[model samples]
Target: MTIILKEVLESEKPILRNLYSLYLHELSNFTMNLNLGEDGAFHYEELDDFWRVDGLSPYFITLNEKTIGFILLLERPFLKKSNDYGINDFFILNQYKGKGLAVQAARKIFEEKPGQYFIIQVVENKRAVAFWKKVYTGLNIETNERQDLIDKELCLIQTFKV
Candidate 1:
């Protein structure tokens, strides 16, 4: 499959916002256990907050111009001095999962967006932990894997200079 990761444009906000609900729905499976809003909406307000964040780059993961997922890459990693980038959020639709599309998209994104990367996954999300391990390993680079304490919580973080 030919996959592309294009930076989300302001004119595409509605399209991106539509995908926002799906992204959050997929993440509902996380340890965070998302709960729907009263109006049955995914409360897309968070998207606005993320957009307003400095150094945050949002992309629409598309397969032939059809949106399938979204990725929020933080140009300024949380641990400022430790790593230069971060994946604040990432999600692919259920039907698209396990198809190796993400890994391919990530490779392209990594190539286009270069930096010392830092990725943090909640310890309880074994799927994320496993997925990232595979992605980094696929990168064929030396990575420093460690546990990090962020916002009074423990998370598994991998740091690597790409």
Candidate 2:
């Protein structure tokens, strides 16, 4: 299973939008704020900002040439912090979970874009917290972790350099 991280293009925004809808639906299980719009679609107002914003990136995670997930990368000036980058959003289709694909994709991104980084996981999302813990351990990277409230949800924030 060769994994590829392809930068999303303007013409392919719709594809990402569709995938994001599914991602949001899945996330609704862990958070209460997500809802379908009047158009019956999950709206992500900032989806287009990836193209317009200087430091935002949208990458489609493809395996064997099929898109299975996506990663939203936030960098430098885009974020109001000294950290080099942040993983704004990451999702793999439910069908693709539990096969170590997420970890490999994450590792690939971190390896390619080496710098100070931070990751946040809602405290209620045990799987995501464990996933990040596993990634940190597997890579043997030291991490600084703390609990914080974000959007009224308690979240575990991990900071480290890659």
Candidate 3:
């Protein structure tokens, strides 16, 4: 299947909401092995803030014209220690797991928009911890921790230098 990553548009708001709802439901049910709760779901207020942020961009991941996941990138501050871009959110349908679609999508993004560093924060739960470890190793990435957040115990902050 051909996987495509494109910028989210205003006309696709409904589809975005539906996809996000599916993700939120999965997270809420603890089906995806993530630690996020209902509070993690995107809300209208968050959407408004995202729209107003010039440094943040939302991307939709599609396979054969069907949207399967999304990724949000938040650019770094000009004076940041690392000129890395953050992967704010990356989610794929449960049915599509283990297909390496996420790796493909991420590779595409990195190729299209190259950066020196790429960061991803994964919840420190069983499944996610394992998944992120494998991803980091398979992709030859280096992992680290960010101590700024109070919830660091529940989160694994990883960074990759490309």
Candidate 4:
């Protein structure tokens, strides 16, 4: 499959917002921070900052001209001093998993953004850790890993340079 990372435009923020709700729901499986709003939908307040803030990017991962997932990339002063860039959020529709599409999409993003990178998986989400490990190994990149706490939740972080 041909993977494309299309930079999200300001006018497309609503589309991204919808997909982000799905991403947050998936994330809720491992983190306790998710809660439904009065509208019975998940919400991400800082999502709008991707457009307003410098170095924060939101992209739609497309295949065959259709959006299959979304990726949020963070860079520079927005993150901790350890890495220059970070994969802030990534999600592929459930139907698309295990076909190597995610791996391809991730590789494409790494190619587009070459620098020291940071990726984290909630420690409770073993599948996420495995997925990142596969992506790193497939890219032939070595990583420095450690455990860290964010919002009182334990997470596994991998740092690497491309």
- Quantify all predictions' global Cα lDDT against the true fold: 0.79, 0.91, 0.67, 0.90
TM-score of each: 0.84, 0.96, 0.75, 0.96
User: Which sections of candidate 4 miss by over 4 Å?
Assistant: 80-82
Candidate 1 per-residue lDDT, tens place, 66-105, comes to: 8888888887633367667888788888788899998988
Per residue, candidate 2 scores C-alpha lDDT tens digits across 36-146 of: 889888878898888998889899999999999999999967888779999989999989999989999999999889999999998988989998999999999899999
The Cα error of candidate 2 at residue 4, in Å, is 1.0
Writing each residue's lDDT as its tens digit, candidate 4 over 29-59 gives 9877899778877899998899888889889
TM-score of 3: 0.75
The runs of at least 3 residues in candidate 1 whose Cα sits more than 4 Å from the true structure, single-residue gaps closed, are 76-80, 149-153
Give the range of the ten consecutive residues with the poorest summed lDDT in model 1. 26-35
Which digits, one per residue and each the tens of the lDDT, describe model 3 over residues 1-162? Answer: 767998888678777776766765654443334344476654433654456667677789999888899887777552266755777667788887788888788777777766665454445345655766677677676666552342333455666665
Better of 2 and 3 by TM-score: 2
Best by lDDT: 2
Clashes of each: 0, 0, 0, 0
Assess candidate 3 and give its lDDT: 0.67
- The ten-residue window of minimal lDDT in model 2 covers 24-33
| Candidate numbers sorted by TM-score from highest down | 2, 4, 1, 3
